[model samples]
Target: MAMTSLPSLPLLPLLLFAIAANVALGATIVKTLPGFEGELPFTLETGYVSVDDSELFYYFIESQSNPKEDPIMLWYSGGPGCSAFNGLIFEIGPLAFNITDYEGGVPSLQYYPYSWSKSTSILFVDAPVGTGFSYSKTQAGWYTSDTKSAWQTYQFLRKWLIEHPQYLKLQLFIGVDSYSGISGSIVVQNIVEGNEAGVVPRLNLKGYILGCPRIDATINDNSKLIFSHRIGLVSDDIYEAAKKYCNGSYDDVTTSEPKCYEAIKVYDRLIKDINKYDTLEPKCTWASPNQEEDMSRRALEETSSDDFILSPPKIPDMWCHNFNYAMSYWWANDRSVQEALGVRLGIVDNWERCNKSLQYTLDVSSVLDYHKNLSKMGLQVLVYNGDHDLTIPCTGTQKWVKALNLTIVNDWRPWIVDGQIAGYTIKYSESGYRLTYASVLGAGHSPQEYKRRVCYEMFNRFIHYYPI
Candidate 1:
């Protein structure tokens, strides 16, 4: 035994090897979390990093793991002026709507014991400065109403990724809805091409998933036709009515016009009772104060309409008033969001008053060229729709998709997940990439509100290759 213990190995080499192994293991553990800089409810960390002097504001949500092994998911809301926080609270996050107390002063919250965070880290971003909590103090500010603003957004996100290198190897997926469809596509295209060309700091982007994305403005315009066709409004009479009264020919129609107003009047009357038997509350139901205020405003508008008299109230009106006060208060309080995004006040008379200028700014046509450029860049574009959405209907979305003229990879067919009608999907493949069209069932503009589980399942399957 004494003879066997004669020779001793060097301790230093063993110690060095152990240290190196531990370091590598630690890096592997950390790489799982992409952009998580620190603890949750964190304040915005702002900095200037790009050539355009673009500023970025970002916060981190702590991972669930002592050593988390979940991929990060970046989330954005639409509006071009809205906040991602809204999506976080209302959609897939831990907290969700608890509408048990319908008559309560404020809505209640219920925690989702099981959520996407079970396998993924979520990053809800206020993009383009003017949205959510991200803001800039410059004169141009955070008002991103154009493609240039989108470029700035790319720069900001690129820099943010660079500043946090731990996310370099983490898989990235851009998730958004509505207007963010355009924004997400633009950002993803930039990231993908930039990485390929070794142009800017790169991100390991996997793919993108959208819900009720508004991809094409022209198609959206044609959606009126599609809806009319689906609902038996294809007659020559309705067609003439639409063109004459809906201001279908107007270059700019967001402003109130006799034709558009009359058309909407007819459209509203037609769909008013379509879902009467559903027993579901009005999608746009507002509080008592809002109802009273809306009634007062409508009364005034009706009184002034001598030429085209708005019919007297029939059934008790649902107070679907605009959230002007809430929007204004949000903008005023979030100076960062306003300044960085250049959200102009007084440009429109009121927050609720539909602004022709704003509508024009949000026009999908404004970004059509960018979309073409993206398509050329080997990107897979998907635009989904919601059939029952009054805000952005499926017909409108289909009209927009058809305008793209991308090669259809998958034929138009019903996308049946369970035993119910989940909506339909059309797939397009061009330049070795695939784009998809998915529609949600019984969903409004915000499909997640109505079909949260199914929507999440679809996205999960699309991005993560998992059956949810």
Candidate 2:
């Protein structure tokens, strides 16, 4: 029997995991990885899904409960350029970086008490060829669009299932958030079409999940002003005046409208200091052309994060809240860490949380039609947003959801977590379809990062079709 092996002492664990997986394919089972103090408690497999010349990398974590029985989730990161590691370490993965320090080395890994993988198997993917550890063999393979990404992802899923036949029967969900919302909708549609065509290794495609999805840029941008006004960021005079002058055209304002431009300018200045993604949290790193965010010479340090961990950076009181992401940047880019994860060298010059330099094209600007069609299908859907997220405001999600026109199964009400009001949620059902819309109160973009346990509880119940 041919047995796949990884480097070092972890090979024994890898062999065990491979035997358990039944079909290893070209996957690497990681037992001991960098950052964490000791051996991992759960099984993690890092491998590539071939999509033509491009190799999309993914981190697969088996369910800690019952690997064979638990449902599977394909979690694609948003940003169209951001790595899926955010959804992994920060959002739902089993292990996460303890972000309590700032001394700037490898961020130590710790077991999250409410990891999504406790009962649900998750596949965190770095898609579109250029995100995270995923890369293309040829330069031409890097250029991708909304439509192309969906098809590629579909093909990837099919091939992945073919390789790991044991997991082919698990109930599947395509989970996406942020800018990937556009491609995510298209991807879901592709899966539905594939299933209808009677494709090989038939997928038990159940439903899809969206978190703070940027469904429509026009609506999202316009709702920014509404969200701002509702949160008391701007005065009523400015808000009403902009509405009167701008005519709800936020993205493409005319040069002729000087008053409107000035109003927007002031609004931008006011919120420029705010981290539009998560208003309550620290404003992390943002890149610029002249100089990079973290140019630390003390990088590639993966010995032990305990020795280097420092207190969290002091957030500035002014317009800038500098929550430096040096720790994560260092941890991911470390040579030892990459080797431990079995990452292909020269695939990417560096690992950025969000590879903003990818040549991604915006083919589908809005997913209004997709959401409407999904609502008609006999599928369960959950659309959640951080109420404080100004980028893809819940107001925009609410507007599109209202457009779905489903019967109100449950009227709007506050949902509780630990006896405190966590957020507001509403339920809708039409035909065989059931949709749940929720808002994570006082949380900014990516509610999972802000309220982990609460978001996990929300997801756990939503997936099981229980009351929120």
Model 1 compared with the native: what TM-score?
Answer: 0.63
At residue 239, give the lDDT of candidate 2: 88
lDDT of each: 0.49, 0.77
Model 2 / residue 406 / CA error / Å = 1.3
Cα error, residue 281 of model 1, in Å, equals 5.7
TM-scores for all candidates: the values are 0.63, 0.87
Q: Could you tally the backbone clashes for each prediction?
A: 14, 3
List candidate 1 stretches off by more than 4 Å: 1-71, 101-108, 232-236, 240-364, 376-381, 466-468
Q: Candidate 2 — which residues are off by over 4 angstroms?
A: 1-25, 101-105, 281-284, 287-324
lDDT of 1 at 238: 57
Weakest 10 consecutive residues of candidate 1 by summed lDDT: 296-305
Candidate 1 lDDT over 1-468, as tens digits, reads: 000111123553454355445434322111111112233231222222332533443333433432144456667766554556455555566544443332322333445533455455666665655343343455345344445555566665554554454554666667777766776766676666666665534466766667666566555545655465565635566567767766465224554676675655565566565431111334342211110122211210111112221111222354221222233223333434333333332321222211111211442353455556655555444466666664455776666556666887678787666676687777876775566778876666567656667676666565554322
